[model samples]
Target: MPTPNQAALDFLLNRRSRPAKTLTTPVPNRAELETILTAAARTPDHGKLEPWRFIVLEKPALNRLAALVDQRGNDLGIDPDKITKANAQFATADLVVAVISAPVDSPKVPQIEQVYSAGAVCLALVNAGLAAGWGANWLSGWASHDRAFVTEGLGLAEHEHVAGFIHLGTEKNAPPERPRPDLAAITTWVDA
Candidate 1:
């Protein structure tokens, strides 16, 4: 019989990401954040490509990113409303970990596998924050897709992209549980 880890299972079943906008101050300190990053690095990496990295944005960096977003939005002729909302994300953020998808060139490891590894890193960071009793949310908006934004805001190279921006902070209020996927509809079992 397989041993059941009830506590871990319970935590997974009940885990819900807090809204980034609702997160407040008391963000994780450097030492605490290092622990979280260590946990995040434990994600699956096929062929050991390690195709992901993190950029932790503190107060000053977040402010600079917000300014860059505003400038990029103007340069791209985006709607003012959209720019406002996008800038707010960084302006109000207590701490954000930018998951950079740095896919390595490898004949054995396909690029798609590298992208999947980066995605796994994103989820690991989210789960690590939640397990550490912090409010966490993975978010990416229009700015994430803009080349100018990626380059100037995040300094991404041609081969790198932003997988996600994980916001972590204390929750002002616990968000109620949202709907969950139906297991029967989403899952399948096969015996061949």
Candidate 2:
């Protein structure tokens, strides 16, 4: 039988991501964020490729990103509402961890697997922050998908991509629980 830690199990069972828009000040400090990042880095990486990294964006960086988002929105002729929502991510963020999916060349590990690992890191970071009593939300708007934004705003390499932008801060208010997926409807038990 596998031994289980009750606290950890309980946390996972009830885990919920706080709304990024509702997050306030008193964000995690450098040391604290480093600890969270370390925990997040413990995700499964096929072939030990470690095909992911993080970029911490604080006040000034967030402001710059907000401006860049606006610029890109205008250039792309995006809807004003969509542009506003994307800009809000940076303008309201107390702190954000940009999970960069930096795939590495390897014979054993597939590129798709490396991308999956990067996604896992993003979820792990969000979970770690929530576990540490911080309000956290994983976000990726149209700006994140824009090549100009990725290169100029984040200085990402050609092979790198944004996995997520994890916004972290104090919870302004408790978010109500939303509808959950029906396991029976989605799950398939196969015996082959």
lDDT of 1 by residue, 82-110 (tens): 99999999999989999999999899999
Instruction: Please list all clashing residue pairs in model 1, or write none if there are none.
Output: none
Where is model 2 poorest over a 10-residue stretch in terms of lDDT? 45-54
Q: Candidate 2 local accuracy as lDDT?
A: 0.95
lDDT of each: 0.94, 0.95
Clashing residue pairs in candidate 2 are none
RMSD of 2: 0.8
- For candidate 2, lDDT tens digit of each residue in 111-181? 99999999999999999999988999999989989999999999999999999999999999999999988
Q: Which of the numbered candidates is closest to the native, going by highest TM-score?
A: 2
Question: Which parts of model 2 are misplaced by more than 4 Å?
Answer: none
Error of 2 at 181 (Å): 1.0
